[model samples]
Target: MTHRIALCGDLLDLTADPGWQVDAGPAVRFRPDSCLLIDEAGRVAGVEADAAAVDAWLGSAGQRVDCRGRLVTPGFVDTHVHAPQLDVIASFGTELLDWLNTYTFPAERKFADALEARRGAELFLDALLACGTTSAMVFPTVHKVSAEALFEAGEARGMRLLAGKVLMDRHAPEGLLDDVEQAERDCVDLIERWHGRSRLAYAVTPRFAATSTPEQLQMAGRLCAAYPGVYLQTHVAENRAEVRWMAELFPAARSYLDIYAGHGLVHDRSVFAHGIWLDDADRAVLRDARASIAFCPSSNMFIGSGLFDWGQAEAQGVAVHLGSDVGGGTALSQLRTMADGYKVLALQGQKLTAWKALYAATLGAASQLRLEHEIGSFRPGTLADLVVWDWAQGPVAQRRLEVARDLHERVFAWMTLGDERNVVATWVAGRERYRRPDATAIPQPAR
Candidate 1:
């Protein structure tokens, strides 16, 4: 029922979590400089990149896309983002709570207007693709209009997007809070309309425990328990002050993570951001629940939050995924997030290897979101959503990659220094969405 497509490129084939010892099956490793990905009937049909394999796969009769000398990897999975925060990203520096109150909260308030929300959705997706991200898990504003606009934008772009109507019924500005009854109702409506519709998915978002009342948490817990496929997202151990607020709000809870686990909100499909302040007990809760923590290094440092103990998290078997965290995070580049993550570890007498960073952003994050089977790697039968990266897109990057002999080192150099400029092209579902100034089409950079 769908058009068959094949793509030729230097695929970043991965078969395991870079940080873990698990096999990614046959897809775990990429060949040096070639691979073919075929999409048949809207599902991945074949994968092989040898000249003969590709020629045979094409068979002189399939729609073909080619990547010439660019790094082609699976679409990036941004496990954490506030779509409404796009307008306020890179605002003048302020601390976490103050920054939220000053720029973030105020800007998100405007998303209640559907037109404004839609405009934001368009801009946000454009910005994401311009930087070569094909799919993402995002945080919508507390407004239902926000989720509706974001999902619509993702649909238009043919992306695998997961988002939700952010829930908050207390400890927030008046307009941002949705009463518990209405919050769950909105989430149920979103699921009925968007979840599993094409590649669009729904998330049960509670903003954070601090902003949601007990009833709101219980409602989310019940909904997630009933809908196993729906993702549960919230903030945990992000800031000490926020943790303290949660403790005061839920005195019966043993720990902040306990609050969510006690309510049935913690589960295998859950994704929480900012574990910078998490303790052993919190890590245990996350591990027991099989929940993923989106390690927001840039956001942690940007807000003067304490460094995340990556080694510690891993030792405790907690899944770690990287996110830009946008406004609270200082950079739009997940590559930059890698660099910041390294710096955070370095400060804690630890190190973040290039392989670790790449894994966290790509396959590791995808596993956390439970979308790996469909999109995380250049496997046969996966949608042809890919990015073409210019290893030497700019002078500085060119110089860096020159002496870098290893894949991890080269990727690290590029990550620490590159931005959208390194994005040579971006594709969605076998279609060219952003071409970096070639005969096919021109990418209109986000203004």
Candidate 2:
């Protein structure tokens, strides 16, 4: 049976990287009255604005979803998050190292139980959907079962997800540690089982330099080399104290990033989270390698880590995308992360425009993951993963929007004030993955 959906609404899509420019006109394509057509194969068929053309396409068979009073955009993609740390979202009063020992590790240890891992996986993905995130690069625990559980859950939901069993062969609790040999076996098994399966992919996750031994890091690098397209995800220069400790651990290495570079892990597919303390040389290395950084502002602030220098990053030509870094970060919603990012940039006298934030959460992130053709944009043949955003329903936000005189101002207000409540619906692969229970789309009256 052929299935189709015609989503009519206010559509906004990006055509280019707007960078830090306040003016979004050159990069954005906005259609006030438009229909996004999704075909049976769950790819975008077309985007039509002509009334006659839309009617002809919809015919009498397609499901016409009325979104006249809403904003339609591609679903968010979170570059870095920990699926096992769902329970530790707001754990209080500890910096990066202590917090990991106190909250993150203990929480992840629960994933050793397959049933617990499955449950966590389901809940974590559901929360992400509710928060309007259709895709993410996730970190599961060291246990193979943890990665398996997340993969299974993501596969069932038809979500584009990248995840891997964490490699932590040293400097951690016994319960959360995997031997280097066993870790390699598990990673190979997972890659064969999950990578390129439906919308699922495997990432070689080392947690960070501090957790993995030299041998384990070497093994991680080898997996990236062996598996051609598998991704490499880890942490670097997130906190000053952590950086100091890492320097002590690898005394001969010129910089924290150099350790990964030496091991052959620096590449376009590598995504290092929280690069808050990296210098120009490190930025140059990342730029040259085409490795991107996942700037986790919320987690940085929440854990008392220092602010990331966005100006320096952009000046050096290193790509930077947003990550909720949930658990250490406050919320799963990328909007909140974007809002937090605005404050983080403000503190440094830099800026994060609304367009830039949206671009980062959607297309920019997907591009960084090398998945732009498949998941990010509304281009014909791209997957129909998208979100319907309700206009400000809350009193405060409604008032702000009412007073706003321009599209950019209104969008900026939405970014600053919006949360999950504004997400009326979320679609993944042309399926309604999540719809707010109390929400109802504004009907297109009498055609």
Candidate 3:
């Protein structure tokens, strides 16, 4: 059956261009009483300012979902997330290296079983949709079955997902290790099978410099080159200890970023997670390569990693995005991630306003992934991946919204205090994927 939905009410349209940065404060267009029409094709048909105009256009053709006083915005885009790590979120204690050895590795090894992988993928995707995230770049375990399972799950749900099998031949468990020859073969097989299929895309994942040998990193780079527009994701300078280890592992390289750059892994499509310890030289290299950093503030704070230098990253012209970095990240909510990000920057005497934080999680992250045109904005012809936020979901939130002087203050209150519960509904491609039962009454589908 053809599906058409009209979401009518307050809307927060992030009309800013893709290049908008933190320095461009509160540059969003908020419509207090508006209507967003999604045609049967699952694309935004139009946005109307007058409710009467919207009614005239609908004219008994589609279902209208009333959101008279709620906040609607683009679906959250998670730039970096680990699907298998969902089970290990919020594990106590330990910094980067110790935490990985103690928790992350062991949990990820469970993905070797296809059933476990499928189960994990289902749970992860459900959690993401419930939290208002419609698209993500994911890292599955080293097992090809893990990537296959994730791809299958994402395809079934019609999600836009970018994932790759983790490639690590050294400094890891034997069960998780894949030699250079086997790693490249499996990656090629996975890419051929899954890349550009449905809404699923491929990323060449190396785990990190410490986990992969020079040969393996080169293979990852070669894979990226072989598949035009394929992405590259890996860790870098996330921990001081990890940085030192990488330096010792690749002594000939000028810096940690040099290791990836030397292997041709650093490029516009590359997304390096953490980047908490990036030096000026590393920033320069990233700028030159036009690479992006997934600024994982929640993970950084959860695992006691150092604060990310947002100021320096901006000053150096390096593209920055946000991530949950789950397990180590403590939560899957982008709202939580943004809140933690604000606190992290606050510690450094910097401020992340509500507008910038929300932008970083949506269009900003999409821009970093080079998917701004398709997923970031509500511009006509874009996919109808939307999040409807109900400010009155809770007493505290309701009270806060009641006093919010303007759109900025209302958004600030929501982001700082909101979580998955506040997401009234999450829509993917104009189909209602998740709707909070507790939110204000929504119209039932027409017979």
Candidate 4:
């Protein structure tokens, strides 16, 4: 059966610009009463402004979704999230290492049961849709079954998801540890089975430098070299204590980033999470390698991790993306992530504009993941993964939007005050995956 959807509304077309590196702000094109046509393959086929043209194009077959007053934008792309740690979100009072020991590792151990893994994947993915997140790069537990569970759930929903079985050889509890050789074998097998399957992709995840021994890191690097386009995700310089520990663990290396670089793990597809404490030399190396960083502001603030210097990172030419880092972070809503990010940068005497924040959650993050051509924007050939935001949903939000004069103010107000309650619906692959019960699209009058 063919599928088609005509979404007509105030659309936010976040087209990419070469000047984004310098400005970090997106060029948002707002097209009111515009109609976007999504074909059966879930790709944007055409965009028309005249209702007559849209009706003629539909020809009585397409499902016309009226979104007159709503704001439609590209679906969010979360660069770093731990699926199993959804159970541990908002745990109080602990920094990086201690938080892992007390809350994260223990929670992940439950994924050893395939049933629990599946259940957790379902819950996490469902929550993501509700929060207007259509895609994400997720970190599952050390268990192979946990990765499988996440992959299966994503596939069922036709979502673009990247996930992997975490490789941790030491420091973690025995239940979560894997021998280096066994870990390598498991990753290879998973890559063969799941990589490039549907919209699912595999990532080689080493649970940061602290837990992985030299041998394990070497194996991880080798796997990346062997597999083309398989992403490598890990932590780096997230906290002062963790950075100090990494320096002690690899004393011969010049810096923490050097440890991964020495093992051939620093490359274009690699995504380092929470680069909060990186020095100039470290940032230089990361920039030269063309690697990306997942700037997890919520997690940094939640776990008492230091602020990420966006100015420093941009100056160093580092590719930066946003992540909820849930559990360690606090909330999965990108709005909250933007709000927290605003607060984090404000304390540093810096500013994050609403355009930059939304771009980071959508196209900016997609570019870092090397998936901009497929998932980020409403470009004609891209996937129709989109979020419909009701700007006038609540009394407070309604009042704010009423008084707002320009796109910047409207977007800033939304980022500063919006939450999941503002998400009217979430669409993945042109299919309505989630819709708020009270949400209603403005109907197109008789034409």
Candidate 5:
């Protein structure tokens, strides 16, 4: 039993880094009235522009989805998000430390209940798919059950998910904390069970330097070494106050990122979120180690955290990508993240070009996760995780799109104005996972 799907639309694919300049060689390939052929194994067969070849693909056994008026691109990859923090979104009036106590901790505590964890996981994944995000690196809770539930839900939906049980042995709530020994055992079990299992991976999630004791942080690094290729995710220099607190907490460390480096956690697989207050020295370390920064713009603005310098990070050769940061951030849509990111950069007298922003959300993020070969492109044999989007449904956006003279201009309009509403359908591994109800539906599959 083979299932194939042919998607005909305005296809856009990023082949290489577009850099900051528009004339950086053939970085992006755009094909109008093109057809994407998904093979039986749920991988991309090719993108055909020839009318006869397109007709032949449509005449084959699979279903032909008419996406004539829409845009198709690789599904977005959210570099940082918290699975247990879905209920924490839009909570008002607090900075990072206080907000965590007020909303984030309380919300995550609910995941101690297996049923609650399961329910939250399902809803979180669905919301991500609805926003055209097919892959994400998520934070569950200190409870082993929370990580298990998230992994289970992601597996059922066939989404690419990287998550781990949080390690927090000190500083804050009692119930949410885990002892270093027990946390290690739990992580080993989870890595054995879920890592490398069907589009899933494990990340050693320490809830930042403030939450974890020195012992726990060292143990987290040890686990990364014990299990080669496991990822490391945590926050860093997100707020001025947080940075000051980290300085006091780890007095001997040279800088905020130095604490992680001291513990042997600075590696190519590490993803440090926020990074608003980091200096050139930190950026150099990240670039040298091949580590990445998950630039969470919406969350930074909402929490009143300082702005991250996009140009500075890029100039220093640090890999930077977008993250929703959910509860602290407003929405799961990467489009919204990019919009906020543009403003973040603008405030610092910088520009986030349309191609650069889109590439960061999709291929750039994938490169950070080391999954670029698997997801993030329309290259033959890559997984067909894609999003079909309507350029504009409202009059204001339609007018803007109508007057746009080039691909970059039209995309800039959509990136600023678009939300989940622009997403008409989402496909994970060539199987439709989400479809807008108000939009005309695709025909049934050919059996």
Candidate 6:
């Protein structure tokens, strides 16, 4: 077929968030023996169509790309990441604050040079695509140069991106912190230029309550309010020391979540990272405000911070999105993050199913970014941000699937052990970005 483009194998889409309770529904909607058809316009024509529909779309006038019977999911969305922290993702043991001082500050300072920031942006987005992450709401360093570098890269690649300048004015190293007035100024400038340009979006990012004084957080809120559809991102109660500092800094506020609420930053579009130490009241407030969370399980476990209660949050109706939390998070792959989330929850006597884990990375993340209508599913008219998964990429993955009893069990085993190797090709808006080298694509064993 000359004009064929179809993603075959297991076609999965997350119809619910991770924090959802098991409803009267099938165990997380799985589509097996499926193929997703996409047109040259980058819209999903249909997924798992009947033989005729698949043949018609494929034979229609467009270039052809095939997945060769691998799992195909909507490209993953990363709700939380530090554009500047990509340099130190697995830096050996440093708690949040110390990590910033020892590694983040010096590294971010290099980004003041636009050339350096651009280099990092290319490397960062390339790494994300290799892991099947099509969209992300990322934290740029305090320098406006950092956001510009990322925006240019996204523009070049047709990426559906959300990014911003870090707003900080207090409790941070001098070189890294921005004054309240200047920080808000940079945000407004970036928002004005890039907030809704193409697939690009801007976020009002206040590094955290600790780094941002009351004045800075209020400014961030004003920026979010001014930009109509812009997003707000920040760290909430991620670590014990951070929580104590939040309590001390915002003594007048009710709790850590309350600090952002007081500034109008807690809205339907806000996504707080590392909600590891939340209480019932905290979950209630976040749910009520409709703000979401980017759960950083790998970062939490890597730093020995605290175990996140995924089960409790979902029961309360608070949406939980997934994040790699790079430099802080151990890997750039969302597949790796899903495995980490599953392991941590299991140890706490809670179970994270394959569907729930996938949700955290895809539609669940799109909901947090309020970009669900555009990305994160196999739904017709959604962007063709698709990933072709290779099930038998390695010995172990192939062995597990060979003996798997059920569909969910097969998917569960894949998420638990899969890495970038399982990702055969990643496409964003129907444009192929990364394809594993032929040498890395192992041939099938004799049947």
Off by over 4 Å in 3: 17-26
List the candidates' TM-scores in order: 0.92, 0.98, 0.96, 0.96, 0.98, 0.93
Candidate 4 similarity to native, TM-score: 0.96
lDDT string for model 1 (1-447, tens) is 244455555667566765532322443465546755555555556566566766666565555555556677776777787788876777776777778888999999999999999999998888888877788779879999899999999998898898999988987898888898888788899999999998999989988888888888999999998888999888888888878888898999998888898889989989988878888988988898889888888888878778888889889989988888887886567777878888999998887776667677777777777777777776666777777777666677798899897666676687778777778777777776776664242222111
Candidate 6 residue runs with Cα over 4 Å from true position: 1-4, 17-29, 48-52, 439-447
In terms of lDDT, the best-performing candidate is: 5
RMSD of 2: 1.6
Off by over 4 Å in 4: 17-26, 440-447
Backbone collision tally, model 5: 0
lDDT-sorted candidate list, best first: 5, 2, 4, 3, 6, 1
Assess the local accuracy of residue 4 in candidate 1 as a C-alpha lDDT between 0 and 100.
Answer: 48
lDDT of each: 0.78, 0.90, 0.86, 0.87, 0.91, 0.81
In model 2, the clashing pairs are: 89-327
Q: Could you tell me which 10 consecutive residues in candidate 3 have the lowest summed lDDT?
A: 17-26
lDDT score for candidate 3 against the true structure? 0.86
- Give candidate 1's whole-model lDDT: 0.78
Give the RMSD in angstroms, all C-alphas superposed, for model 5: 1.3
Better of 5 and 6 by lDDT: 5
At residue 399, candidate 3 shows an lDDT of 96
Q: Write the per-residue lDDT of candidate 5 for residues 1-447, one digit (tens) a residue.
A: 175677889998788779987554588878888889898888899988786776677565667777877899999999999988888799989999999999999898888999999999999999999999999999999999999999999999899999999989888687898898999999999999999999999999999999899999989989999998799999999989899999999999999999999999999999999988999999999999999999999999999998999899989999999999998999999999999999999999988988899889988888888898888888898899999999986999999999999788888899999999999999999898999988775554442
Whole-model lDDT, model 2: 0.90
lDDT of 3 by residue, 93-183 (tens): 7998999899899999999998999999999998999999999999999999999999999898778899999999999986898899988
TM-score of 3: 0.96
Model 2 weakest lDDT span, ten residues long:
438-447
